[model samples]
Target: MRADRLVSLVLLLRQHGRLSATALSRELEVSTRTVLRDIEALSAAGVPVYAERGRHGGFALLPGFQSELTGLNHDEALALLVAGSRRGAQAFGLGSALASAMRKVVDALPESHRATAAGAVQRLLIDPETDLLARRTDTEEVPDTVVTEVRRAVFAGHKLRIHYAAADQAPKWRTVDPIGLVTVRGQGYLLATRSGSDRTYRLSRILAAKQLAEPAQRPDRVDLDRAWQERSTRFRTGGDQVTVLARVNPSRRGDLVGTALAVRAEEEADADGWLRMELTFQDSRHAEWALWQLATNAEVVAPQWLRTSLRDRAAALATCYGVSS
Candidate 1:
């Protein structure tokens, strides 16, 4: 513990030239005496750590002492700069600190690599995703903050109380035992347990949240990765792919073929001047949904069930819209 405190004290002095014993103790989570002892140990190890016992003094490193990181190689220096830049130089809470830290890393790099790194930034324009990374100048997102806190709670085995927002229902507050954080494409999701049932809450829909220091016993649910995989597969396998064969009015053949959904059509001038069309969909639901749009323009000839469903839906719609069904 003393060695750990000593290392932390050294780093603190390197980052900050002077720190009071109380400050160092609080930072290292140790007693004031332990902080003094760590300073003595650093001195014993030729760390140039000095202590001043007075109303205005505590611990200070000798002037011109170089940080251990100051001797980094060119690539290491550039990497440090890249890491520092991620904290954001124009964003709140980290702008000035990140800028200063990045400057130090760039300045420490070998003269050869420094120009190359600078030139790369100048030559490249990283057009930030306007929709994904969009942020207001001052207003912070509560959902985004909740997502971050939920992730930390999941890792630390803690519970979270959240106010959740749903489009079709009233906003409600609930406690969730955080299980895992999933990133789908670019959106974040939280899988949690509520009242002994597993559920997923989209991070963007969480209105507010706070992590509870106390942890509830997390359930031995199915492995999250496998569960998600199975869920996805089940959804994709829900229905069989079917082909819809339709007879289109010959006058509509060119218009039908012009559409992306029109798969294939055979043009044979029947007595009624109609052409036959075929389209494929992963499930009947898609075919039915599309058929509702093409009423009168297309007539379903195969898959009697789909045709019946479409006709029933159309009749219902017609009744609801005050048309003679």
Candidate 2:
């Protein structure tokens, strides 16, 4: 761990030119005294580290001293390049660090593989802005300050006070014990607890956030995957769950499954090649919303109310389009 810290200290100085012991301590999550001792150790090992004493003075390395720590193979360099292409780091407030690390990785690569690996990275794309249908996927915008504070609270094991606005609701302040942060499909969420009950808040919905000084009321260690899975199970089982029986065109099977919460059962295909299936949704509105997207490709078979709702909507749509039944 100390070795890693020393390497990081060198890299920090190399990147920023100069940084104070206080800044180093904060960045490294250590202490000022530790930073001083590490600086001395680096100098003793002929690292050319020097310190300046003044109001604006800090530690710096000799001019043009670059470390030769580039030991990445061709495949390793390409892998790092591909990983850097993802926008996940931006959601985690590590965009700048990822970019910096990518730059250093490329610079450290051997001359022969540098250009080739970079050129290969351009040929691959991850999470394109628009899909094949020309419809763009919306990305949630999160304030840097909000993400930073929430992240600090999660790592430091402190309670977080946030002003969050849920859908169609007024924003209000709430104190939550942050367990972890999760990002799905470019949208970030803070998985926390309030009054020992699970709560999930969208990061973009946070209007303001403050990291409280009091220690968070949570376990010392948490298994994020298990917690997330449990939350998902509760969510899937809890809401106003409704099951809809429908017959859908085979070509539109992917679309239906993607929008529905779960597929309850599948029946044999009809003479016309339409597949019958029972699908679960959150509520009537959810079932209506999803079926509406399928248009004529799917038909609701059971739960007469849902069929009537879809028919009414279709009738209204036809009326607006001036089509006579």
Candidate 3:
């Protein structure tokens, strides 16, 4: 761990040119004294690290000193290249940083592996704009400034005031204690609390944001995965929830389950290989939307209302195609 810290310290200086002990401590999650000691150690090992004394002075390396610390193998390099190709980083406002890091990773590689890794990355495509049906995946627009402020508040453990425009609701200002930020399916959300109640706000819905001077009212440390799971459970259970029983074609089982909130129960496949399952949805609209995607591959067996809705939709679709029954 100490070795990793030392290497990271060197890289930080190399990247930023100069940074104060306090900044290093914050970035490394260590203390200023520890940072000073690390600097002393780096210089002791002939790393050419030097300190400048003044209000603006900090630690820096000799001019044009680049560390040869590219310790990635071929597969590792390729993995990083593939990750860099993804569009997810743009959602969190880290596109430029990812690009810069990718460049450094490629430059650090040995000459023999560099060209091959670069060529291999060119052949891998990720998150293409259009699918097989030529349907485009719409990406939500998140302003860089909003994301930056929210991110700063999250990492610095500060309160945030946001003007959020919820769907079908007027924009309102709310001060929240931000716990963390999560991005799923190319959309970002701020997982936070308003008046000590769990609140999740879509980043795209946030029109304006500001980091407050007061510290955030949150735990000292957070387990984001567990927190997210708990929030998800509450969200799935609470809304206008509904359950539907359905018989789905075995081939399209995955398609149905993927769109559902949960599969409450699943029975063995019948003689004709149709799979019976109980599924949960946020509401009638959610169920209707998901089932429509499956066409004839799925049939809603229970809940007369959902079945009626599907039948009506089918009739409407048929009418559009001029089919008379």
Candidate 4:
């Protein structure tokens, strides 16, 4: 309460310039004696506070007085309130500081303006989607330290020395330059340039990583933005343009169009509301993945060889599992 009142007194003096003892006491919810004592305290603490006796007399800060509250305009003041409130509630070590800072600003406002600023703070608050964040972060919780270093390396164009473990091998250390970092459904990937080859490293596979002091330089800049385009162009320029015709159920049409592997070239609807889509796949692996992803919602209608290969692979998998074929 002492701290709050002291800041409030500073704010009142900074904003109102001059007010009578009656007005100051009423605004601060204290007596005239308390207001006088606060003024003496401010003076003793080297604050340029003084009482002026006139028609417009109360308490005022010196004209040259500079506080964080002094320089803020309307937009900055509102932004500060909104950001501080959001940070205070969501992040640690912010709420008390923000509340204290807000009190200081409020104390500087004229008696008339204080209510509006306080009301704005009350009305605007941020509540993030707790359920969605829970579902996302639950599946994969990468160490915060690894994420921090990866972000730093990506931005600074530095190579990373990392201990990479894979399904087939024991963990081993390698130096790779990070191109981009992406997080999907709580799974993080580092699209990296490794020894002149492009690859995507799962964050889960990374045992430990640190940004190297030496900077990474790419020879003939591989545009990370154009990675999909590069893959597409490679397919277009390659031999044997394989075409796929698929009949997709209406309920699953969204899944087809939205998926990265399947690029729909044409779409047609039937009386039954099912969608027949002409989807292009870059290669056999791309098509197989898309078909498996779509499951019972789609069936291949063209390219006999590719269809036969899918069946053959399925049969082989069934054989391995000792299922009746």
**TM-scores of the models, in the order given:** 0.42, 0.72, 0.70, 0.44
Error of 3 at 27 (Å): 28
| Candidate 1, 115-234: lDDT as tens digits | 788788878644343445575223223343565576567767888988998769888998989887655434456777788776778776788888898885586554878766755565
Order the numbered candidates by TM-score, best leading. 2, 3, 4, 1
Task: Tell me model 1's lDDT, rounded to 2 decimals.
Answer: 0.65
Backbone clashes, each candidate = 0, 0, 0, 5
Candidate lDDT values, in order? 0.65, 0.84, 0.84, 0.67
Model 2: lowest-lDDT 10 consecutive positions: 70-79
Local accuracy of candidate 3 as per-residue lDDT tens digits, 188-251: 8899999999999999999999999999999998998888899889988998988999999999
Q: Answer with 3 or 4, whichever has the higher lDDT.
A: 3
- Tell me the TM-score of model 2: 0.72
Q: Candidate 1: where is the Cα deviation over 4 Å?
A: 1-109, 122-144, 219-227, 234-325
Instruction: Give the poorly placed runs of model 4, Cα more than 4 Å off.
Output: 1-139, 167-169, 183-186, 219-244, 264-267, 270-273, 280-325
- Residue by residue across 1-325, what tens digits does model 2's lDDT show? 5765676788777757799999988877688999999999999999999988899999999998878754444323433543644555677665544544565666667758977987998898888989999998777888888988998899899999999999999999999999998877788889999999999998999999999999999999899889989988888888799999999999999999998889999998999999999999988899999999999999999999999999999999888899654
Off by over 4 Å in 3: 1-85, 110-113, 269-273, 323-325
lDDT of 3: 0.84
